[model samples]
Target: MSQQAADEKLELLQHTMMNWWVQEHFDYPWRDSSEPDWKRLITEVLLQRTNAAAVKRLYVDFFFKYPTAESLASAPVEEVEQAIHSLGLRWRAQYLPGLASNIADGVPDSSDELMKLPGVGPYVTGAFMVLHRNTSSTFVDANVVRLLGRYLGFEWDGETRRKKWLLDHVDALFSHGYTPSEFGYALLDFSREVCGRAPQCQSCEARTQCAYFATLEANNRALAQDNS
Candidate 1:
């Protein structure tokens, strides 16, 4: 398809997905814009490879124990580790103190400054900017790559999220009238619910414009015809 056509299709897909999200989307404490910046940034770090449900269970208690970055920064490393021990990334405990130490005053608004802190990278930084700073920025994790790749009929290797072309398209998603937080929330929830590893393609509102669903339907038709 032509580039213009592809762009139009993506806009339509984003619109459809956002509309569905408005009807229903996952709720998480970290998604609340009113949350302290430190809490928001810390939640994103804990959520790295951990499940959102797990994060939800621990979130309130975690904040209660270490109410501010200064409290966490001053706490013993062992206690910090114990607090998040259930999250399964014990190694992250080491960085948590340092990350909190740097942000004890407050989380930085600049992406470059945020990246300078321990354990913060592009994904975390982008998420902080979009969700907390209200910036029109985009970021992708593996789930995002998988969801967008399948929808657009694109292939992704482990490094696809870093590619400029793909990143450009991801940025374009906002041009369709999606607020950064809304789009971020919608994309994350939609990826988990509808376009997951084993997607529920049949019921997906965006399936009609989805390349993966089209391919799935074509293969299914071929198999049925062969059986007949």
Candidate 2:
């Protein structure tokens, strides 16, 4: 695609994404700007390979019991495990205290130092940067990678989200009209809602413009002709 065409598509995506977020995005406590950095970071950890709805159900109560990183850090591993047992991944409960211990010192100002902490990785760091730090970064998880890869029609040999081309593309998209947090959240929600592993391509709002949808439609048409 030419530079001009890519810019136009990005603009349209930003407009469409922000609109969807305004109307359809799920509300999460961690997305709240007023939430403390520790809570936000912990929420990200909890969200990994766990459903957002499950996290939502226990978030307030979990935080109320612990309140701060220092409090969580001091809590027994067994207690922490029981606290988040409903979220599953019982093994993850063991790491909570160590993660909290690291954050009890304070959420590190530098991304490098922050990632050194337990359970903090690119997705978590990116979320912190865009949502809390008000910086431009792309928060990529499976949902995000699926969404962007399908919409933009990109391929990578390994870890699509971590690849420079994908990250740069997402960062560029976020640096434009929409705030990264808004766009990032929209990507996450939309991917889950409309563009899942078995995407609802026909019903998706961006069907006409989405590369994946177009490809699917074309394949369907060819199949129909062959059958006929």
Model 2 C-alpha lDDT per residue in residues 1-228, reported as the tens digit of each score: 544455566666666666776788577888887888888888888987688889999998999999989999989999999999999987878878899888776687777787888777777787777777767766777777777677777654447777766766676567676666677777777767777778877656666677887888899999999999
Global lDDT of each model?
A: 0.84, 0.77
Lowest summed lDDT across 10 adjacent residues in model 1 is found at 169-178
Residue pair clashes in candidate 2: none
Cα RMSD for candidate 1?
1.8
**Positional deviation of residue 170's Cα in model 2 after best superposition, in angstroms:** 2.7
Compared with the true structure, model 2 gives a TM-score of 0.83
lDDT of 1 by residue, 71-152 (tens): 8888888998999999999888888888988887789989989989999989899888887787887778888889878888
Best by lDDT: 1
User: Where does candidate 1 stray beyond 4 Å?
Assistant: 1-3
Cα RMSD for candidates in order:
1.8, 2.9
Best by TM-score: 1
Task: Give me the runs in candidate 2 sitting further than 4 Å from their true place.
Answer: 1-8, 155-158, 226-228
